[model samples]
Target: MKKFASLLAVALLALAAVSLGTHSKATAADKLPAQVQKIKDTGVLKVGVKQDVPNFGYYDSKSGKYTGMEVEIAKKIADELGVKVEYTAVTSQTREALLDNGQTDLTIATYTINDERKANYSISNPYYYDQVGFLVNKSDNINSPKDLDGKTIGVAQGSTTKTSLEEYAKSNNLHFKYMQLGSFPELAIALRAFRIDAFSVDKSILTGYVSKNNKILDQGFDTMEYGIAAKKSNDQLTNYINGLLAQWRKDGSLQKIYDKYNLDPADADDE
Candidate 1:
């Protein structure tokens, strides 16, 4: 009878452990929105990120790993969900399709938030602010916006840089010829080859490509907003990210990430 009692107690303890684990998981899921809860339950968060753009979201071949401010942000979000992060490298041209195809649960690809993008997907509140800037060969004597007039500028394909620069040129009474490339490296190569006179993008992004032969112009324009994005049906996920962004912005976590990489986002007039 004592042996039977011992076995029953052991079973009770096992049952208690299972109950506790289930209760804890339920409590965690209850704290998150439906989309976010699904991430927590899945044990992995699939993120779309850029493999270029240096400090923003670059993959380092030397380390065989991804490193950048945006990558860190994605890791942080995965931590909040208690999941491992799986990163898929994306380009400006491929990020949206990855989300639409459900290959990625979120995009932290330095995705610019704009009216058209917001209409198609759920974009969280802006986490970073930057302005359009140009990178040109030092020998070209293209020091400012006016110098780009009638110049063939290389822009990343599917990026908003061309539109922003066009507006700037229109207001300043200048004209530009643009060439679209698939990546920043391609644009840089074109600039080096003299195929394009200038390579234009976000000032912060331009900082990553600066070499002794090329430099970012001191002037910038069109303040752009960068935000995390999810599928059009995932408003819950977007709201969850917005809450984290708000908390991070309040607690200085976001600024700390920038400082870790020695990044200073350029303002409209700040050099």
Candidate 2:
């Protein structure tokens, strides 16, 4: 009877250790920064993403799912926080507004980090680098930016493409007429209808739109640095995200995602 009682006590002690281990993990959020802990306690991470950007943040109607590099990044963040992720599709013009209005905890919608924008939000280090390129109708035989001088150029309304192009044009002694569109698909449609001579945006974005009807110009301009953005008040959360980005970049986990879609970030900085 004494021997059997001793064995039972040992088994109970082992079970207690396992329970303690589980409890430790459950309390991990208690150690996080207050802002970061607040996010984890909410049980959901609301991410603002782009539905139309393929290989970055595309939402498929048939699959009812979001797929792409940026989408996976958001999922990784949610996983780290041990929370469910909900996605809200945002456009260039609406992304910052979403952050300002507290509609999204983070905007991972290929948001380019610029001097002025950084002043208004907490932007992370550049996650992806890109440059502006143009897509023109194949029949137009538009060979270069110079070829489009004095012609109509369509850019997403809130994007920096037009201003960048204006700078490039001025230095090269060329001029372009500008048309601001609400979305990329709308810009492409306008290009197809000959309403604009060229559609310009990030080269990786242009890659998704290229078809037999249109071709991307070999020359690109303005190095664009894409980063995740949060409301100015979420400094701790942004810092937490920066830590994740640093870890992924150091471990090559980010490159693995880029490889999955055959994306080449190095080409993004081409002139």
Candidate 3:
């Protein structure tokens, strides 16, 4: 009996050792493919951006080309890396999916860094700070988010601003109908035509719209910082992008991009 018990103990110890070894090997195998290393090896940077969102990321109508502050910044990063830039238009809902599926290497869209998104993706240092605000007819009585209660709020579909509005409504128990428009241009049209009582988006974006059509709407609110997003496990890519962003901030290239569009450079705070 004593001999059998000793043998059993030895067998258990060996099994445990084998299990641990297997676990360690599996963990090492599960590490994400290094996207930055691959990009560097290939010498091409794939950037995803928005097709619309003036002064930030948008397509020029007259020029029939995509141009915005983020576009220029992305160009600079590509230039510094000495690689060709491949720009792809990405919607808010598809941004994370594209990165995870390896369709794009990085997203330069106006992605707001939040806890929920950070859990699934990596975000670089903030390139711009803007408030969550409303755009209403200049003559409308609505002035703040609180005033939005019981009013229809129009937001661009799949945007962080839309999520923020939903969260605020839930937290405050406010009852407001949220209308998700397909695009920023659609939302602008809806607000102008009174199809929705108000439109909520980034202050800078709303300001850009107002600048172009001053007689119709007014800027109403402010929010938090926005950053570029990459895949969560792509640590190498994340670090490389963060380094580039730091250099841009230090050398004032980022500010110059903001200034080129008449935006306040102070708004581009990493914090």
RMSD of each: 4.9, 2.5, 14.2
Off by over 4 Å in 1: 1-28, 266-271
Better by TM-score, candidate 2 or 1: 2
Once fitted onto the true fold, the runs of candidate 3 whose alpha carbons sit more than 4 angstroms away are: 1-34, 167-174, 211-222, 265-271
Q: Using Cα atoms with residue i matched to residue i, what is each candidate's TM-score against the true structure? A: 0.89, 0.90, 0.77
What is the per-residue lDDT of model 3 for residues 92-166, given as tens digits with 9 covering 90 to 100? 777778998988888988888888888988888788877677777766666565776899988887887766777
Winner of 2 and 3 under lDDT: 2
TM-score of 3: 0.77
lDDT of 2 by residue, 16-52 (tens): 9999988997687477999888888888999999999
Better of 1 and 3 by lDDT: 1
Give lDDT for model 3: 0.77
lDDT of 1 by residue, 115-193 (tens): 9999999999988888888899999888887877888989999888888878888988999998999999999999999
- Candidate number achieving the greatest TM-score relative to the actual structure: 2
Q: Residue 252 in model 1: shift from native, Å?
A: 1.1
